[model samples]
Target: MNKQVMCEQCHKKVASAWVTKIEGSEVTKFSLCEDCLKAFSLKISINSQNLPLDSYFNCLNDKEFYPERLSNFKMCPKCQLSFADFMQTGLLGCPNCYQFFGQQLRPLLEEMHGSLEYKGKIPVWAPVTYVLNTELKALKNELFSLISQENYEAAALIRDKINTVKEKLTKA
Candidate 1:
């Protein structure tokens, strides 16, 4: 947890010398957190108040029963994510659960169109990937619904199957 670093400019003892990505290697730049970072001229912004460009902010606190704090949501009571908002915009507040929430996102995609995939990993409409994705979407929706309905057995089975598919996806 504890790390020791020196400032690049003054060689002074620093605690968090930033990770400066160089041409090849990720060189740690020993610089003043503020001044050193500016000196490096890396594309970074500090104290950035600009909202997420995904437009998720508009619906941030729109949900009537949303928890006041992130501790409330299973992920974070303060998650404050709006399923309705995500459905309308097809965007997310943060990319945090964008992957993990795939199952939950399926219904929205279905309502929007007959398909769940907005974009493809391989190509616009690769038949194999499309088939596999359709299967994955069905399983994901089933898992989410089962869990919500308290059908533990079905949910567990679907969960295992999803894990298998996820593993295959990772390899691919």
Candidate 2:
């Protein structure tokens, strides 16, 4: 009897017929079996088409993907399907994602950006060893001074800068 190999993604025994090797790239791409290849191929094809992320959500209709990632709520307005529709999922989909599901997406956005409002730019720096502590602390001190002077607009900008610096200093 031949030992069956399973797909890394679906973990089902691939019947050898579905297995195919892809050597076109330098990446080490191989699952012990083939279902993963099919899943991987579909993902690649969908992305290559430049379609929006929401367009291929139907591919997730299989129901085995994300079991319970979200609070397991937030249904799509168009289809009225809840998070339970997919096994595991995140709150990113549709241009109206913020409009349609702001509450649901808060954790996700906070996960990506410390603040939802795009106040301004911040440069990335290496972590650890009191890196931006001085900068952030100084900004905080300056913000307090500005507020004390009753310069409300300037204080707001300084407060935003302080928040941005603190966001950068701390990981999301």
Candidate 3:
């Protein structure tokens, strides 16, 4: 027999959607019913076009979850693409749109990719030091965020990991 999972949000309905967030060594998982998932998706589609998922979920119970309007009037100088156009099509006009709309794109990119920094596979030919440095950089960023959140235990663990990576870099 299969066990059904209840929605974490509504608690009254069986969950149809699951969401997971990973931060450093920490992981968080939650489930949502079909109705609640649809409502949340609709809110993202209709209300906050570029809002971060974290902010939206954090303010789910708030009456004023929507923030001030983004620059609708702003346009990319290279492709003449407006933020509204990008919102509608979900595509940037050109490479220059990255720089032109960087401020507006940051949250959306973070929401979609989890981080502004690219974490794709490194080339096999890449130097060991390069790889170790990249790992150290990411660990340091996580360490800072953990410190800000006052999770000293986790921060200490990350610090040790960072030091280990640094030692590897020195050896390389």
Q: What is the C-alpha lDDT profile of model 2 across 1-172, one tens digit per residue? A: 1244455566766533233444566445445443334444332346457554334545554466573453365555544344444325543444544455556657666878876777434445644425467667778788889889998899899888877877776673
Best by TM-score: 3
Model 2 TM-score, all chains together: 0.26
Error of 1 at 160 (Å): 0.5
Quote each prediction's TM-score. 0.26, 0.26, 0.32
lDDT for every model?
Answer: 0.57, 0.56, 0.77
> Per-residue lDDT of 55-133 in model 1, one digit per residue for the tens?
3323444665354432223231124344555545666766664654566766656876768756534554666656667
lDDT of 1 at 132: 65
Error of 1 at 18 (Å): 94
The Cα error of candidate 3 at residue 49, in Å, is: 32
Which portions of model 3 miss their true places by more than 4 Å?
1-70, 122-172
Which 10 consecutive positions of candidate 3 have the poorest summed lDDT? 39-48
Winner by lDDT? 3
At residue 73, give the lDDT of candidate 3. Answer: 47
Weakest 10 consecutive residues, lDDT, candidate 2? Answer: 35-44
